[model samples]
Target: MADKHNDISSTELRANTPEQAVLSTPTDDIHVANGAADKSKNQKIRKATNIILIVVAFLFVFHLIADRYIPSTDLGRVRGFVVPITPQVSGEVIEILTTPNTLIRKGQVLARINPRDYEIALFTAEQNVTQAGQNMGALTANVTAAKAKVVNAEANFTNAKVQSKRIFTMVEQQVMSEADADNARAELASAEAGVASAKADLAKAEERLGSEGENNTAVKSALLALEQAELNLARSEIKAPTDGVASNFRLKEGFYANAGQPVMTFISSEDVWIEANFRENSLGNMQAGDKVEFALDYAPGEVFTGKVAYIDYGVDWGQSEQTGKLAQTTGQTGWLRQSQRFPVTIHFDDEEAKGLRRVGGQADVMVYTEENSLMNLFGKFWIRVVSWFSYVR
Candidate 1:
């Protein structure tokens, strides 16, 4: 009975011992080491994640600075001067001398008007000038004849006066009859009246002849009419005023073109420019002579460089609209307002832009300011990417 109790107590003591003390083997050691290894790996992963996050944050900040300092806008367009072609004289279109989209030079004849009426007018004016000249010649002849008549009458009057004085003396000395003296007085009176009439006629003739040969009032007036007629005849041919391309050639044969009305639009080939509508915030560092790069939709995959030529001083806001008697105010939505864009004109550096005929075509523009940094390089890269994307988009 004592041996059995002792055996049972020993078994209970063995059963009550901890498992770690009873089973302290290699497997247990491996399990403990694996737990510690897992904890250390988690700490290393957290450290690496923290470092990556810091780098990403720094990069994001750098990109933001790049976008702000270097501004860009997609709302750009090719621009050129548009001229309205109008005729100075009203007439029927006798001929159309130009075709649509044809290049034209200054003073090139675009069309012709029916000049028959103008020619007839010019001929009539010339005939009137000839008639004026004939009339002037007749007046000059009349003046010369009147002068001769005045000289003859003056000689007769002088002889008559001498005879009257001799007759009066003869009557007073009783060497002549009273009837003879009376006859002599009558002849003298007739001669004096003739002389006075001749002088009046001469004065009238001289008044008709002006200071110079062609300075007669009638001749001058006729000459002016002739000049005007010639001018009108010349104006019958419509000519271009500048070098450009003729567009919208709608004038056909027999169409009556009104005076001073636009017949076509002429796009000047003098200089081409880009009109970029940039947000107000983007214009802070922008100025004239700033370098710019642009890509056109028509000329995709090609980047053209230029410089900022000018900035618009004003924009179309409430100030431009015609308002009522009361002043107008601009309405805005809360917090989510869009910035207004102003126009900035850019001029191309080379003549390559002249090859593009797409006026008002879409373009992407980037203005490189005086600030030279890595940000600009990024901006250039971004623009190149955009230019490439333009090919597919």
Candidate 2:
């Protein structure tokens, strides 16, 4: 009975020891606490990510709204009116008075053609004018002499008629011979012919003299030719038509310049402007007088201000390509069609445009619309950032 009792007590002790060891172990509790801590940290991280995504989405929407209202163009260029220097008259270039890339004033003599021929022509024209004046004087003298002759002829004719009439009367009274009466009739006929001849001479003299002595047809024609000769002489000296710089001037002393051919290019600095190309969809709010900010590659990091001067009304899309009488359509059709860009002219501020010689230079432009919003400030900031980058790019 004592051995059985000892064995049962040992078995109970072993079972109770195993249960106590399981309850007092600290490894399971440590694992459960670590899991709870990991779950809490994950929850916090997810919350932060969700907040960040929401903020980014909101900012993106705002940016879209701002960009939709404010139009901008990455493709812009400095433009100005290019004046082609063309000669009006054809001649050999005898002298070039202007140098290439030199500033010239209006009416300044740029070059000279061979003026010897023109001078000779002018001299001939002057001689012709002098000869015409002498002829006019001679014609006047002739007219005076003819008028005097006409007066003398009229007097002689009257005297002859009177004498004939007296003779006829005498003959009728039987105091004169019949031969004398026949001779008197013959004298009357001669007097009538003399009177007609005198009247014709007077008419001829008046016709030659014309209404005004100095304004005779021949004299007027000669004077017009002289004026034309003088004009041609003056045109032989080519003159600048405007205040600008002359470019591409390759004319020398002996080159024969053709009439109406462009010899050089004149770029007018006073009429400089910018031509910006904007997408068609971005011009909904654009109007004349809108403010513009632009950056030129030549003037990097400097933002120049300008105002919208005009918007092109016509574009190539609406233009019809004519194939004979039929209007062939040139409209583009594709899944990824390119957006058409139209030109907008911007006039720079006079003060800011000074000292900038960037004609046909690349530029980036941004147009600020009338719409006001908080995002517009951001848009301006972005533009400023781009301008800053322009320094390195």
Weakest lDDT window of 10 consecutive positions for candidate 1: 318-327
lDDT of 1 by residue, 297-386 (tens): 887788888999999998867665455666667777777598889999999897866667467788999988866776688878988888
Off by over 4 Å in 1: 1-70, 147-203, 206-214, 320-324, 333-336, 371-380
Candidate 2's error at 346, in angstroms?
A: 2.1
Root-mean-square deviation per candidate: 7.0, 6.5
Best by TM-score: 2
Q: Which TM-score value belongs to model 2? A: 0.78
Supply the global lDDT for candidate 1. 0.86
lDDT, candidates in the order shown? 0.86, 0.81
Cα-based TM-score, every candidate: 0.71, 0.78
Query: Whole-model lDDT for model 2 versus the true structure?
Result: 0.81
